[model samples]
Target: MELLQLQYFLTVARLEHVTEAARSLHVTQSSLSKTIQRLEDDLGVPLFDRIGRKLRLNEFGNSFLRRAERALFELEQGKQEINDLSSPEHGTLKLAVTTASSLPNILREFRKKRPNLQFHVQMLNMQEMITLLHRGEVDFCLSSPSIYGDDINTQVVCIDPVLVAVPKGHPLAERDSISLLELRDEWFVGVKKGYGARDLVDSICESAGFTPKYVYEGDEPARLSSLVEAQIGIAFIPSTAKNSNEHIHYLKVEDHDLVREIALLSHKSRYISRAALEFRDVVVEYFGEMA
Candidate 1:
């Protein structure tokens, strides 16, 4: 029932290995085990199913985890709220982003206005970002293609057009625009499958009757343009990430609504600090200027 026990349990559940969790928690393995045992004794239920050295959260554990996470989230929010109330001018802004290409400029502009504010930003995949949103772990999530949920508030801050990038000497570069079908046969450089832009492009291409043949797949969307410039492969590059490289040509996706909706996401029931509100305003304004 204690917060420390709950914290240790959550860590163990996430890692699924007591020794590793103990290491992460910076405690002795025996102490961690004893704490977990004490927690189980209080609950009168086995939270985990043990398999050798690893632990799998059981149904009881899963059920308890949800409530535990919410309790911790609320407690953390209370702390943040108190801090915000005491000193509204300087507070940490925690954010998760699916795409980081537009983040530098957005953060730079926000920093100019609130130079005293601190930022903690994480570049995560779409699902990870959404999970954090649900957990109330991040103050806001800058997502692509927008996420929807009953307890999540989403607003599209930017609509970045997705374009095909080709080397100047490539045959596709001769055209003003190319259809998704036309690129089906060509090799592509793209972000990995979980990325919002990558998923959007894949969905569109699937609708267009073909899956893109990726010659190179990576986590970084910004590198797609550079890969195309090197003639490694053509790629679907968002306009927001496009570079002014003379060696690369960006082609429009003819007859398709090829765009990524950059969205700001927050938990509907979670407390948002003044810093978060100002950061949201700055994000909206920053993308507004681009649009």
Candidate 2:
């Protein structure tokens, strides 16, 4: 019923002990118990099974707990967004990025300009990024590699030369560059399904007249490099993906002239927060210089 009641219920359910919940909530046990009882009465169902001093969500309570937590979190997020709207310093910014490599300098520029802006960045795939944007989970996303249509507004932030990542000792590692056609049958590592980078790789492969045989699946840039370093497979990644490892060799792909376009995306119907809008300008300024 009440948010505080839901909050207290979650705490009690999580701690599984009324004493701990009451201590954490900084309230007397009797007060907390009465609050939980009142919430149960309002909902017409019990939220916890009282066993001595312990509290646990039963079958009905468990299901309610999940929904309650989600509802409570959404309410909290909405409240914070409102507070942020009221006070710039207290606002929360949510950003989803298909892959961090796509926009190499965008985030850094954001940090410089929005020194005090709080952000929650989800390392999600392309579909998730779009869904998050539509759901208002994130104000906007850093993307340019997906199949999103007219529902969202976007701006190109950067361009990155694509490269083939390989183990240091691989035959192709010593080459300064290789054509996409040259690695036709080579084993590859790729971002997981719905990842914008995976879509980019697939799009490029199709354009080059071959289907990539991805042997490993994940969206983590570091893991892909590890796969390359172990000689397990090669990966197509932005040149910036070369950092943070020494055993991997990254060779720019020639002939294809592959370049990943980094773009900022937001829902057409949604208004981006002021901080995000300002950060977008910083991104444009920092990466606009790139071809």
Candidate 3:
């Protein structure tokens, strides 16, 4: 029934592991267990089913979680609103992004406008980013593979065409454009399966009548350029990833509809702070200039 209990329960529910949740909450497992037990006692029903050290939300917990999340979200929004009213010029901006390629320019532009404001950035996958945005944990999220939900509002700030990157001395280096079918016999380096870019690459290759044969698979999209530079494998790099890596050559994909959309996401129902709004405008303008 207490606010602390609700926070602990929500953390536990999200993680589903007592020790992990305790570590995340910076509390002992015994204390977290006692708090959940107290919450269940007050509710007159068990909230979770224990499977060894893991906790699975039971029917009661599942049903209560939505309400608990909304309650916490509203409370956090209220706190943020108060903070914004009291000190509108400066506050921490919590943000998450799936990729960091375009972030430097965006942040540089944002900093010029609000030099005193602090930024807390988290590098997360699309789903994690969306979850944090929906929960109002972050002020905004910039992500590729745009997310959709009733509570989420998104703006497509930039659309960068995906390009095939190759080693400078490679056979295709001189080519201005190449079809996906031409890369059928080439080795590839790509982001992991779940990534937005990776999924788009896979779909594009599939449409071309073959799946990409990746020699290396990694979580970091930025590393793909280095991989190509080493002549280890070719990769699909977004236009935003344009860097002065002279050893790598970027070629357009002929007849390939591979493009990544960078989106700015915020909770539709959450109150937007002036700092967050200004940062969002900077991002939109930065991309607008690029277009």
Model 3, range 50-167, lDDT digits (tens) per residue? 9998999999999999999999988988999999999988889999988788888889988999999999999887667777887878888888888888888989988889988899
What does candidate 1's lDDT look like per residue over 26-115, in tens digits? 999999999999999999999999997799999999999999988888898899889999998898889999988889998998888789
* Highest-scoring model, lDDT: 1
Which of the two candidates, 1 or 2, achieves a greater lDDT against the reference? 1
Which stretches of candidate 1 lie above 4 Å from their native place?
none
Which is better, 2 or 3, measured by lDDT? Answer: 3
Among all windows of ten consecutive residues in candidate 3, which has the lowest summed lDDT? 125-134
In model 2, the runs with Cα more than 4 Å from the true position are 1-85, 102-109, 146-148, 244-246, 289-291
Better of 1 and 3 by lDDT: 1
lDDT value, residue 108 of candidate 1: 91
